[model samples]
Target: MNTSKSAGEIRLIRLDRIEVLNPRERGSRVFEEIVRNIKTIGLKKPISVTPRIDASGAEKYLLICGEGRLKAYQALGEEEIPALVVDVPDEDAFIMSLAENIARRQHHPLELLSGIRQLLDRGYTIRSIAEKTGLNHCYVQQICNLLRMGEERLLIAVESGGIPINVAVTIAGAGDDDKAVQAALQEAYESGALRGRQLTLARRVIDKRQRLGRAAGRTSTTKHSHISTTTVIRTYQDEVKRQTALVRKAEFSQQKLLLVVGALRQLLCDENFVNLLRAEALTTMPKYLAERVWPNGSHA
Candidate 1:
């Protein structure tokens, strides 16, 4: 958002009058982080707004950017916020807003796609989008195709960094040919285009997309229940509990193994016990237990 070394004119603006140019659903992690950061350290950057004269000639600010920060301040119950007032045409303001939101930073792939579509609606070509946003032309085209096809799941995977951009492009070009898609992915993996854990994640994403045809629960038999923070938090808590129990059991098992090894070492060192073992025709201890009891190749 900081376009130059010199700062812009900062002023206190009424939060209620500023209109978000491109609004999105709230409660995402970015929104939560913005709220948390404002509460923790105050707003780090002033929002950008353009001054507009309404029908009544009253000064109203059209929010060119900073929807997240604005929403966070509203959530904090603040009536006014610090903002940078910029004098620009509405169209240019929108372009700047789009640049800051989608192109400047790493964003959710879906958001980037939507923003690109918005830019296209605003009459910007692919080359213009690339020049303004600093994205490659091919990447913009691929995103446009994905958006047009409504490939939400693939877009999600791309956004999450589970698959590479090149792989996604290849898959998008593969159309409905599952075999060609698989071949392309395999070639990418074999050629070292994808490596290590990325291949595993890419496979999972492709399989899940091919099988479910969308994100989980989208194609369910029953009616789609609304997704909310509470349900997600509850599921996370359950998983945490399960993992905690498993960890505790593992620790207990480790402790028991140590105790048994200590006891066995003591018994192996006792001459009477060795004699009793000899008399019982149990001279040779099990290889596993013997290795632990006499780790240094001792008499036992």
Candidate 2:
């Protein structure tokens, strides 16, 4: 440990006392690169630390941040490295860890997602995580999406930045049906398909397959032979005529109903015309004539 006093205002401590916060389960190539840099250039920047008081009233320095750099220094077997000690609460320790990682630019996308998942598992909400880490809510939400992907090969690609974040998000929202998701992913990989296109194709294929399966199942239970060509043609022609008649009848009925409705609306709007019709019916009009003129019980 090499400690140099600068301005005598800040006390620098050794790296041995600093602990890692929210350690990642997966190994990071980025961390290896940082270790290489440290081996070549030495410890250029000091990591941040905070004091944590124990139940016995003894204060110990806990690493509030800079986990990657600390790991690098430890791997290099350095006896000590520079650190800054401050007072911080344990509840805020994870936030400091995230900040330090972000500042050092050592955490990869997957590692960052893993850390976010850790914080969430520890009961941190997305809003609180964003506030504490100084990140936007959307960014935190995106990381949370990656966590939702869980332990899948697609998630691995997402973490490695091989897959776009949006693509990963779409895949994550596919839910826990592994076979369907895997099939979609396979198609995507084989065809170099976009995520949206992949999802659309998958849905279409599934729907088509389901329809075919239902048709097949229905046919399998019934004993039916192929009809003769003449019979088929006759059946088709009959169906066409039937459909045509139905359509024409529907059109005619619609027009008739609309005309009747319009005429009734006009009669209601014209008080004079309605009163005149009513008077005519009440006078010496035949019962049949009156019924014909006002079929709906209206005066006109």
Candidate number achieving the greatest lDDT relative to the actual structure: 1
**Judged by lDDT against the true structure, how good is candidate 2?**
0.60
List runs of model 1 lying over 4 Å from the truth.
Answer: 1-9, 25-33, 36-41, 55-57, 104-106, 212-300
Model 1: per-residue lDDT, tens digit, 36-126? 9999999899999988777876778889878889999999999999999888888888888888778646565666777887988878888
Q: Encode model 2's per-residue lDDT on 26-129: one tens digit a residue.
A: 36777788899888887677777666555666545667656667788888887676776655567676677765564334455555655676778888899988
TM-score of 1: 0.63
Clashes of each: 0, 0
Best by TM-score: 1
The TM-score values for the models, in the order shown, are 0.63, 0.47
